[model samples]
Target: MKGPHRIIIVGGGFGGLRAALELVKRRARLKSFEVTLVDRETRHIYSPLLYEVCTGGLDADMGRASVQELKSGVAVPFSDFERRVKKSRLHFVRGELTGLDEEAKEIALKDGRTLPYDDLILACGGAPNTFGIPGVEEHAFFLKWLPDALRIRARIAAFLEARRKGKERRVCVLIAGGGPTGTESAAELANFFQRMTDAGVLDREAWHVRLVEAGPTVLPNHPEPVRQAARKRLEALGVDVMTGTKLNKIEPGRACLTIADDGEECIREADVVVWAGGIKPPAAWKSLKLPVDAKGWLMAEPSLQLKGKDHVWGLGDAVSFMHPKTGVRVPALAQVATREAAIVAENVTRLLERRPAITWNPPEYWMTVTPLGGHHAIADLGRFVLTGFPGYVARKVADLMYFCSILPWRQALRLWAKGTMVYMRND
Candidate 1:
């Protein structure tokens, strides 16, 4: 009620970062706000391109920069966060969020520290969900964080290295999920290993990539035509597509599955297994005293504020909303989070001014770009679709636009070039 309003934004995913950046942009005009963005990590990962990193696509030579540089090229460090937020009076705190003290308007970190805030923003992102599949937690690799990608890359390279040295006879890579992530990873792995074969590091018939989806088909949310096109492309690229196949269990060096076609049990030998099935709100969320949905996603008013409390706001994968049209909940996505961040910024500023808060409307259209790996991709633009080179170009342009909107122009352009060179190494 006195001096500048203290605002603490939890989570550094797209939503939290953008929200902080938006405040940074208006710090001059809005002088009554002090913002702090808290997160466990310093690097803001470009999740869309994370698959490229996992597949070792970022380890090649980009004209002037190595793909290793490009792997993090799209990522912005917390120091960069400092640069952007410095003049705006915003601060970045690196720590794990353990819980919230809503009664006292404070957030508790894991290291026995708590931050009191006049206003709180939660954007803590989603964690990968294995749907209770056994052994997956230990044996399968994930692709959510930079470390996850790096782990997957290391595993892949090790397998290839062993195979090349004749220590391992064959490799079977099983991907247990058919969403865009799983599909893209399968394609990239096939391409990456194929390059190994081209270099005489792998035998053409020595490795296999299999994708299993419990759903009726891959890309279940996309239009049937887009799904068909992607399916066709994947098959052509030599990724075995197993639709209606459920992952019963995953063990060391193998996976148990139920084939829907025959309703029979089967086991697939595997050297590497990847899980990209689904995601859920952070575990800490379930422990918070805030009002949460049945599945633990925070409940918020249409204004993105806690249902009955204005001091706390929610967005990104941490919150839930009822779809007015379908009467169902929607999954969190980067685009949606970005939009939600904008709304939170507006509403938070309005709250500081004691102005009426604004409501968030679900976006009517969003461009979904799914890279099929090795210079080709598919773009679903709602009414129609673009495939082949146009799709690839469109996605690149979109990436450039986002980077430009978020980062300085020079860094954005450099990232565009860096990403191009990294992916084009296959040629």
Candidate 2:
């Protein structure tokens, strides 16, 4: 508390980045406070558009931005800023964090470096949930990051290319889990295959897209009517929907599943496997001696501060805080992350000013937009749901709105125009 307060934030996801931005904005007002953001990855990925990247509907580069680029955009004055600001001293170390020594207030990195901090924020985000299924970690592809999306795209292209050479001449895609990510990915794959077949690049008879869900219906988080509409839309796109199916195991090229209703076992061969089941907190959090919920998510208060830790805060998918109204844990989504980020920013500001933290109330509009490939989408906005062409337009507009909200108006308009032109040309 004597020298400038050093605030170190781990993970460059939405929560961490937003906190850093807010800290930078308040630099002129504070006399002595330094913020350093750290992450294992070099770039921050927009996780929502990852499915489109995998299906070639959108370029992979469109879904990521370098951490350095993000820093540059914030315009923190280097002269008055902390020395770490010079020569990219933000400690972009690429390694796993081993553990935290609470007594010493230091973070031990895998590379043998210990970073001491006056305050810390954990925004490490979530990992793909494997449900303890065997062979999944080794063989299955996840859509969590840009690399995952790129790998999926490459694998799909390779599969298709191999088919052209009469190698089995059959392609099967099995997408596990039926959340928004899985549903959107399945639709994208169906659309990609349909377009390829229409253009004589792929054979309709040779390609198959299967969506597997353990729940009674796809989009288990959505309302029943919305789920039914999504199912119908997917069916129309030739995606095989297998509901009430629980994955038992995954072999080299096949998946063993048990039907939830009858408990009957079945095996299906797959050329490409995508695991979109769900997400869990990162493995690092499990080893930490901090307070965590039964689900392994960090237990944080409504103010986004970690339980039993005054100097530490948590947010995004890695932290679980119950909703004041619903009493249920808030779902992990970009919108939730954004709202949490603002609250965290204000809380951090208040903490710096020696004032009490403000209460964070959940936003009312928990809307979701799901793309159905080729300028088609489905949207559920709480009270109302829209599908087909109108839904697609709304989805595009919503995407633009999110970008516009975060980015400068000029940049946001450019992205919107570029996206519109690309979609039109592709159509």
Cα miss at 339, model 1 (Å)?
Answer: 0.5
RMSD after Cα superposition, model 1? 2.3
- Write down the TM-score for model 2: 0.88
Show model 1 residue runs off by greater than 4 Å. 57-67, 86-88
What is the lDDT of every predicted structure here? 0.81, 0.76
Task: For candidate 2, write residues 1-427 as lDDT tens digits.
Answer: 3877777888776676667766666665555776777777665555666666565532212233422222222222322223324333243444557789888888888889888888888888888999899978988899887678778877876776577677867778999999999998899888888887888877788889999999889998888878888999899889999999998888888889899888899999877889998998777886778889887899988788898998888888888888888887888887787778778877887887899998778864588888877777778888888888888889778767865664567766775665455444323
Q: Estimated TM-score per prediction?
A: 0.94, 0.88
Question: How many pairs of residues collide in each model?
Answer: 1, 0
Q: What is residue 289's positional error in candidate 1, in angstroms?
A: 1.3
Lowest-lDDT window of 10 residues in candidate 1?
A: 58-67
Ten-residue stretch with the least lDDT total in model 2: 72-81
- What local lDDT score does residue 381 receive in model 2, on the 0 to 100 scale? 82
